[model samples]
Target: MDRTRTRTRYFTPSEVAAHNTTSDLWVSFLGKVFDLSPLVACFQGDPLLLPITECAGSDISSWFDPRTRDIRRFVDPQTNCIRYYTPRGRFIHTPPSGPRSDWDNDVGEPWWRNLQYQVGLLSEKTRWIRIVNTLTSQEQLQEVCSEETMEEILQRYLCYNSHARSYTWKFDGAILDMSATLMENGVPDDDQELDQLGLDRDTFIPAVLLHFNDDLTEG
Candidate 1:
């Protein structure tokens, strides 16, 4: 038997979920995988690392969405300036005329520039699932089976609804662990249709439930 390990060309959402830690941080944004472990190490103890650390081991796709309301909070409408919260509890506001204002103007590119961290695409076993917010009764049908991970789904869900402050998910009455891979917990990894996951076209898996959280920072 060959002792050499084969590097995976694709990663399932569950697979990505397993690396959510400073020592093994990995996140996917815009279908690209990023191993942020090295970056995490460099930013250790830094406040700048708060956002990334909070999202380690998850899909950051929602974070890059330009339409996301979260960005509006940091922007000064009158000046079109962007306020960046620093690790030292400082605020760095960049005016529209600033060189780095391009980042605020176009959020996706900065995150896309991190492609050097690409690992692989979403695994073939991935499946899309419908997630519902138990509090507001809002629903988002997500392709969990595709390249997107649970983290990504949740992020997008939150971004779409302004009333939703925070959320936590559960499957089969048990809280869906963000750090745990769905594949390991019995989610089928195949090219099957929605029915294969025990769901109908309009009917979703009742196992997963999104619960609102008071802590808005919890991702």
Candidate 2:
């Protein structure tokens, strides 16, 4: 008989949340979890240069992209919804001829590759969804609502509107009954999970309209 042991590679939400401190940090990106404890040590005593400490033990999936070197995505306030920016115009390309010529033309892989700090897989329940407000035409917001109520979801967006108390939520063209709890309504309670509301994981929930009541005193 042969005996061997394999390391565990999957992690639950509770397990990941437990390590959400600067000294012991873990975050998930692109479905893979990473332990950032070592990186935090490098930035110790230097809080101004880079604020990696702020992201300790937090899911930074939205903050970092592995494809491009553009750092704008990390700092943009509208990180959730997609927006197209005007191109910076074309530039002349002059080929360099030297022993290291290949390096000049090649763009390197994402920064995450250098860290090699993978820890485990992200639990499915922790996945998030991007919701858009068609009425305001504002940036989309991401929400993870496996355990939240419909009222709770509404509260999250209240800050975006001038009249927080006067707003209606719609899904698939039907107005949602805000009074009903998401769990009881059977409308996919979790943004990541599938529900009869006809929402796909990748698709955005459209037209969250806000309407203010007429001020009778003004009349």
Residue range with the least summed lDDT across 10 consecutive positions in model 1: 85-94
Q: In terms of lDDT, which candidate is strongest?
A: 1
lDDT of 1 by residue, 1-219 (tens): 211133335566777899998899898766667887877675578665677778777876665444552222356476677654233332112223345533454434333355666777766455556676677667676545433435544554566665543666766566554534565445544444665776555543434566777632323
Model 2 TM-score is 0.36
State the local distance difference test value for candidate 2.
0.49
> Global lDDT of each model?
0.57, 0.49
Question: How many residue pairs of model 1 clash at the backbone?
Answer: 8
lDDT of 2 by residue, 1-219 (tens): 111123324555666677877788777666667786776665556433143445555665554455651222322254544322212211112122223533355534433454477875665554343444454556545443434444555566566664555645555445556655344444453453445666674563323333324321211
TM-scores, one per candidate: 0.42, 0.36
> Which portions of model 1 miss their true places by more than 4 Å?
1-8, 66-75, 82-112, 124-219
lDDT of 2 at 67: 64
